[model samples]
Every structure is written in C-alpha cells, then in structure tokens.
Target: MNKPVNRHPFPGTPKRVGRVGAGRGFSAANSNTRISLPGRTLDVSAFAAPASHARPGNLGLNSDRLRAQMIQRLRNQGIQDERVLDAMMAVPRHVFVDEGLASRAYEDAALPIGQGQTISQPWVVARMISAMCENRVPVKVLEVGAGCGYQAAVLAQFVKEVHAVERIRGLYELARGHLRELKLQGRVRLSFGDGMLGLPNTAPFDAIVVAAAGIKIPQALLDQLAVGGRLIAPEGGAAQRLILIERTGPAAWHREELESVRFVPLRAGTQS
Candidate 1:
C-alpha cells in the first residue's frame, strides 16, 4: 500500500470537451481538495494471521486472504496479466463500497455505490486494465465513468497518472472521498463532468478506459488518444461488446471487438 509521493503539482483546468454524438458537449470540473494523509495506518495483521486463529462468525471481512482468493478467481477466469492481478490485490475493494456491502466486496460481483452506478465487477476491471497494459505500461491514462474511483485507484498501480471523470455529482464526491481516504488523491485525479466528453485538457492519454457502454465510441476520445495508445470501452445497446481501439497515426486508427459486457449506458452532460 506504500505509494511514492507525487513530486509534480496537479494539472490545470480541463481543456478539451469531447462530442457525444447527438448529445451536447460538457467540460470537467477538477477537484482542488488538498492532499491529506490519514494519521492512522490500517492494521493488516488480520490478513496475515492463520485461519486457525479466526474467531467464529468472522468471515475474514478485512483479511488479505479474501483478496488473494479473489485474485485466484480472476486467474481462473482468464486474467493473466501479473501486474493487473497485483494491482487488484493491492487495493481493498471494500474501502470503495458501502459499509453494508463490505462483506461482499471481494465476491467478484458488482455492488451499488449510490447514484444508480455500481463499482464494476472485479473481473471487468482487471480485464480492461490488463488489455490496456498488454502493449506497454501507459504513463498517462484517462478513465470515463469513474464510479467510486475503484478502477482509477487500481489503474494507478500500473500507470504513472490517472485522470478520471464522473458525471454524477454525488458519485463524483463519493469517489473523491474514497480516493482521499486511500491516500490516492495524488496518483488519481477525480473530476466532476461528463465522462462521455472525456477530459480534453489532459488529452493525448497513453491509454483510456471507459467504464460505461456507448452505442458507438465517442470521437473526442478517439482523437485524444496518443499515437500508439489504446482505448478500451464497451459499445452497443441492448447487447454490448468490449471494443479496443488503437491510434496508429494522426488520421489512422484500428478497432477490435472482444468479449461481451453489460455496463451503465454512456451518457452526455453532467448530473446535478
């Protein structure tokens, strides 16, 4: 859980706004909250303690063993990237979810995180990140539909910087709080804006991962991708498939379809 201190200052205002096809364009509002590290460190002894010492009815709620088991499940499900697995294991999923749902955090299931959005299933997160990093470890990354900030936090483990945008104000705030609690505000920058538009000011990302599914990939996102970079998103309506787009040159791009997925529809504009 130890992270390097960010030497550089946070980036400035979001510059570009992506077009959402028939919908209007929207800008991102960056979170300016100062970084604050927690005074108390998390006690992880429970995770290392032997199972024989476990108390009755204690389902290893805070145990690292649960995370290890989750990682094993991801491997069995076809997640091969060791970096992705380690990153997922490093993050505590329960921290980004609701208290009531904490017990089920490592269950490989998507759980509600308020505002009609759910923290994505663990497998999907690992898959998208694994795909994005397959070619090269991206230095800068953008994440659309950054619900609860879990994916972005996980991305931070593999990427140098992460810029995440969320349209819903409540989820935006919720994500901000969760990231701060995890002391990841430096590595992951959370923004309140339309995710469909993508963060233009920080354009030309080495990799872009969209959490929600759109009927078609947004052009603005495609344009913002750096040359040789890749963008992975879910595309379709009624039924959806994971789409991976690689920017080969200034005017040339390549698209490939992989595994079917279900995600909240990608929307334009911001929610109050």
Candidate 2:
C-alpha cells in the first residue's frame, strides 16, 4: 500500500454522499510501503510502485488512528455491530480505490473509480454487512456488483468465503487486482458476468449482498439463498429501500425493509 504524501487533507465534513438515484434527491459524490500483506502486487509494469517506500512508522499508525475514528463515527451513526466495525477497521479501504483518490478513501463519502461507477458510502457498506451478519458469520457469501471489491473485501473479513460478481469488464478486472493486491483473493473471488443472474453453480450461499438497486429482487438470487440465509439489497424504482430477505424454510421467506437508499441500477450481461 502507498501513502499519499502530498495529497490534500481529508475534508472535515464530507460534502457529498455516495451514488444517488437519478430522480431521487440526494447529495452526489494501509499495507506497508512496498510491503505486501495479503497478496502479490499487481503487475508492477501496469501500475508504478509508490515513489517513496521509506515512510515513517507514524504513517501506519496514522491510518490505524483514522480507521478507529471511522469506527467511532459509524457507532455514533447507528452501526451497532461490533463485528462489522472490526472488519471495517481491518480492511484498508484505500487499497480498493485509485491511487489519486486514496486520500478520500477513509471519508464516509463515496468516490468515483472510473467507468462512471462509485464505491458505496462507508456507512452504507457497514450497515449492509452488519445486517447480513447479524445472526452469525456466514460460511459462504455472494456479493453482486463488486465495484472495485471494497464491499466484498469487508464481507470477506467476517465470512468464510465471498464470491463477488461484476458485469463490467473494467470493474471486474480492477476488483480482481485490488483483491489480489490486498492478499484477500483467497477469501474473495471476483467474476465477470451478469450479476442479475446469481451464480447458480455455487447456489445456496449463506448470505447474498447486492450493491446496486433493481426494480425488484431477482428471482435467481432468491432461489440461491440457502435455507436460513439472508439476502440484502436496495430494491424499488423512483424510491429505493434497503431490503433484507431471510429464507426461513424450503418454501418460505421473511422480508423486511431497512432504510431508504440510492444506488446505481443493477444491469444484466457483461461489458468489455
């Protein structure tokens, strides 16, 4: 992971929230230096290594301190799950965003990462992950819309395995590289495919999280949820609601709506 030495300081108050719906009214938007903790660095040729690797010991401490602050903010904002907070603290979010935007990575707001896509707000990510894991740690989790793999990486911290699907080729490759660089590739697997059609071959996931909003919950995803499993996603048109569906039995499911949210539309098929 590379530290931003000359980057602008993080804003005291976030100016905008993450990706908002078009018709909806809303505000629009780590690893040791040269040290590889989780996985190998991307082909160094594609992306240059940081100019400076000899960062002061305080740099890592600063990141830790910032994460702790984020955790506190999340707690005050209603993220009560300690497990989710811990995972947020562990994952170096900066690694998942472009180097230029690394400075704002810790902010609660969302930032663009090319392809007109944006990472979800930290609060949203924490809230969703917390809700999905409220009962217990899931053995296998499926994540739709991997967007740079930030959400999936967070889920990986608390789950046995995470299989994230992304429809865009650019994002899928970026996410794959990010996860690999973080050495979390083992816990998270990224695939370039249509997310609307959930991975059936690996059906019956303990939990499923969709980062994009759809007019209605995709039946393919619902069918893949294991008995007693939970699926959380933003659904509805014009107005979106964060919904949680728990498969209670072979043929029954209980659904509950959490908070109102805005996310990019979930699309079908893959793009190169």
Candidate 3:
C-alpha cells in the first residue's frame, strides 16, 4: 500500500457534557480548547454547535410527512433493505442542509453544502448503505468524505459504530455541528483528517463507504478492511461506476461493479 503524503491531526478526546435532549441544543464541553495535530494546531471552538443552530426551526416543510414520502420513493426504487429504509426514515434530512434548501431536502437530488460538496441524493445514499448491509450488519463502519455527516447519521442507526473522516475543515466542522445537534456524536465519531488514509487507529472496519470518486480505490482503505469486510466506492473518471470490494481472505479481495454514478473527484490531504 502507498503512504499518504501528509498526515493531519485528529480531534481531541471528546468530553462528556450534559445529557442531550430532543430539540435541545448542546455544545461540546471542551469546545473552547485547542487541539494540536502533528503539524497544525486548531481552535476547537470553531467546531462548536450553538444552541440556536442545533435544531433547525420550522423550514416550511412537514418533516415527518416528507420523510415518509421520501421512503416511499425509495421503496419504489427497489431499496429492499428494511434496516436501511428504517434508518433513512428516522433521520430528518433537512437538518443537515441549509434552511434555504430545506424544502427540497426530501427530493431525490443532491444539494450543495458549501465547499464544493453536496449532500448526496437520497437514493445514492440509501443504495450504497443497502449494498453494505445486504449480507450482514456491520459492527464498525468507516465513511470517507462525510459531507455534512448525513450518511454517517443514517448508518449509525443500524451499525454498532461509525467513524467518519472529512478532508475539508469546513465540512468536517459542519458535520460535527450537525451530528452534535442530532445527539449522534456518541455513535458517530467525526474526524478532521485525510480520508485517503482511512483512520488507521480504528482499522479493520467491518464495512467502508467512500462518498467521492477516485481513479482507483485507495490501497490504504483496502488494507483497513477486516477479513470478510466489504467496501463500496466509485471508480473511474467522467464515466464512473460504483464498485464493491470484499476482503475475502487475509490477502485476497473480490470486486464487483455495480451501477454507474457521478461524484466529486476524491482528493488527498486536508484543506483549511
């Protein structure tokens, strides 16, 4: 496997704040501190979630009704994994997007989330997650390019734990705030680092999902998968196709090509 050119710092250990309640907003207790990465120091306060922004207010849409409608559309599209469907239904998609676009949150379309990234369309998210959960429920999962943390939130509903990494500092902090607002920080660990590296400290994940397209799957990611684990990512440029890789044995892997899809090119290193 090839090594990453640069290594970024991970966030400081999360401290326990007060209990999080529904519709109630809370910030990290250590939000005011600073975390020192290998070559950079970041002000943790920038990642804090304010009470006002924690829970989105009335966005001119009936959240539950719209979510139900979206699930119906998924069913129509052949998303058979009941677990994935249930999870998609449970999470309020609007909260992860800007208020201006909240009305269209339930639509099967990808919306911009700043920083040149989009919260993936509902169908693609459901499809990728369903493919991972087809055979068995993954105990530990890693999500690369966790834009706004929407997919990780949905994955957390059925999986034991989800470790998500984002290379863009803005998106990483955005994801942190959103997950914190949903009170899912405990189940989903958000890391601000290079997604190509694949979180070595928490390696051998049962399943992995990459949100962007790459010329080829990162070798580091392949090595991180445990035996019997599976990874889903988009490969190729311009004409991209979703590929599923299964770690069949210690040194062997099986690859299958699935539906064609489009996504932003996956890049290396983090950006401020």
- Highest TM-score scorer: 3
What ranking emerges by lDDT with the best candidate at the front?
Answer: 3, 1, 2
Q: Is candidate 1 or candidate 3 better by TM-score?
A: 3
Higher-lDDT candidate of 1 and 2: 1
- Itemize residue pairs with steric clashes in candidate 1: 15-201, 16-200, 16-201
Tell how far residue 250 is off in model 1, in angstroms: 0.4
Please tell me which predicted candidate would have the highest lDDT against the true structure.
Answer: 3
Candidate 3 residue runs with Cα over 4 Å from true position: 1-55, 59-61
Worst 10 residues of 3 by lDDT: 1-10
Question: What ranges in model 2 sit over 4 Å off?
Answer: 1-60
- Taking all chains together, each candidate's TM-score versus the true structure is 0.77, 0.77, 0.78
* Candidate 1 least-lDDT 10 residues: 42-51
Q: Tell me the number of clashing residue pairs for each predicted model.
A: 3, 2, 0
lDDT of each residue in 83-102, candidate 1, tens digit only: 88889999988777666667
User: Superposing every Cα of model 2 onto the true structure, what RMSD results?
Assistant: 12.0
Q: Considering only N, C-alpha and C atoms within 3 Å, which residue pairs clash in candidate 2?
A: 38-183, 39-183
Of candidates 3 and 1, the better by lDDT: 3
